[model samples]
Target: MAVEHNEAVVLRAIKDLVIEPIPVPDLKDNEVLLQMGSVGICGSDIMYWQRGGNSRFRLEAPMIIGHEGSGTVVKVGSKVKTLKIGDRVAIEPGTPCRRCHQCKQGAYNLCPDITFCATPPDHGNICRYYKHAEDFCFKLPDHVTLDEGALMEPLSVAIYACRRGEVTLGSKLLICGAGPVGMLYMMAGKVAGASQVLITDIDDNRLEMAKSCGANHTINVNGRDKLEVASEIEALMGGQPEVTIECSSVDYSYDLAINATRQGGCLVAVGRPSGRTLLPLDVALRKQVDIKGIFRYVNCYPAALEMLSTGKINVKSLITHHFTFNETLRAFETAISRDAKAVKVIIHCDQ
Candidate 1:
């Protein structure tokens, strides 16, 4: 086998990442072995490298650091019937215990015992070789490349956000932040039939990216007050948005989002803010707005993959930078450094 030993990008401590080798273990009956092709450096991954913790999950010890990945199957366990050796697939990082109540209700992402990749106390897949549950792996279509497969993870988030926000035809949308998540939200909102999607961000580069990706209006709210921007956003949309997806993780952004939404609209928070933030509760109560929070996604991978395969959404533009497996540390540096103008950085796993 090509994978005689496994090499991974491990975070030993804050801002410390090194390529380390570990023994490759045999696959379980329900698992499939993969030769990683591309892995994306998500915001959480960057946070783990910078702060040793990403708001919710903190690194108590050394751990592999990535979950947005896709690869070609090198081996399959005896019990695996749906996939085979040499098959290309996108890996769903979260593996939920099928026996859990949430799993029974088809909300496996909410399962208490879910072991998500790159999260604390769980191993991730930013490595030369990875083993994952067969059921969680979705085969990529012939038209979708491995790079596109890796993007399925974030796109799934957008899909879930759109669903939670109830984005439909003629719906007016407002998205806070034009980062990767916000960019995905803009694209997903369009696919969900949103008539108008306005995105706000501090960075002009990101706002331009949002425009290229399908944002109806891009606002640079760098120095503007949140309340003032909220009013401007309403004016641009002709009125308050029917749905607002907050992806900035900033206190002011959240505040503005709540105020910019229509009286009976929906507000969805997708960003993982570092600490607790205040909300406009009085307005929410009086307006009867629907406030919802999404943690990861369930049953969105297949839909996301289909969207990519059919060309309903194009994610290739989202990838702004690329690095090799050995340049893992440099990749993290570029990801965290705003000067790089990095939207999404992909690490090509050398197999």
Candidate 2:
């Protein structure tokens, strides 16, 4: 039978969100129903909220705007033997076409036909209840909170980024940006066994937050150019870092990342740049630097949940503010403002 539920709806830009009743689809043979618990407001959510567009996707029509969410499995289908009702799970937002070559190679994040949540015409999981494929609903262990479950989405991306960057034990890391993703990358670095981590940001408050998250040193790039910031980071580390993670979409951040790494070090491009700009490809080529770009994340939810469940990384400090489902609009407003006062804004969907 079809089920009914209420979901927070973003019907237009710079407007209030509404909770309205909607029909939930009947569970398919490989699907499960989830009662959403907590969701983290992401940068993309803020962009869509303020200007009503993000890159290729735009608010051509009204859409729900959340993808980093966690919930409890309220119902399960016949084929779902790995999960059961009442199990807390992190729902993977993108459903890639499994038949694609990218999916076959275990890099489904690049699948062209993938339909991701929070994108235009793709209703997100800001609803009180949601139905998703059982295969994508990863069961969370008892020790992991729903908040941590929600964070698994971004953490997955970080994991993929770090792996692509080849970060490992004893790796000296420098991160550019102190937002949610950058902070999580610090935690990921720890779990990956990095002896020390360093981060820099324009916001002093965010740089302080990065210290709490395990940054061994912090650099203020407020008035410094890319090269100047790199010199500061190098002096702080006593040498260029082995791995540099670029978490800010700003061009200078990218430049700093490229210039801050050691001669043979790796640079991971994790953030999406806002505008087309020239980069120092010539310098990188001369130094033989390895550069890797991330699309989203592939097969990382389970490990991210475990990172919290096993206490390998702390995430409680990440959620500094909270909002009820009805206050999602306000949540986005605070997020877009780059309020260092608000580290990670969490929205309680079922409240």
Who wins the lDDT comparison? 1
- Distance from true location, Cα of 153 in model 1, Å: 0.3
Per-residue lDDT of candidate 1, residues 1-351 (tens digit):
566988999998897889999778689999999999999999888888888888768899999999999999999999999999888999999999999788999999999999999999898989999999998999997789999999999999999999999999999999998999888888889999999999998888888888888888989887788778888988898988999999889988888888889999999988767777888889887888888999999999999998999999999999988999998888888987879999899999953
Give stretches of model 2 more than 4 Å off.
Answer: 1-3, 14-16, 337-340
lDDT of 2 by residue, 1-351 (tens): 234555565555545456666777577888888888999988887777777777667877777779998998888888888888889998889998899999899888899889888887787888788888888878888888888888889889888878888889889898889988999898898789777789988988888888877789998888787887788888888888899888887888878888888999999987777679567999788878888877888888878877878888778889988889888767766776654488788899878
Q: Candidate 2 clash total?
A: 0
lDDT of 2 at 310: 87
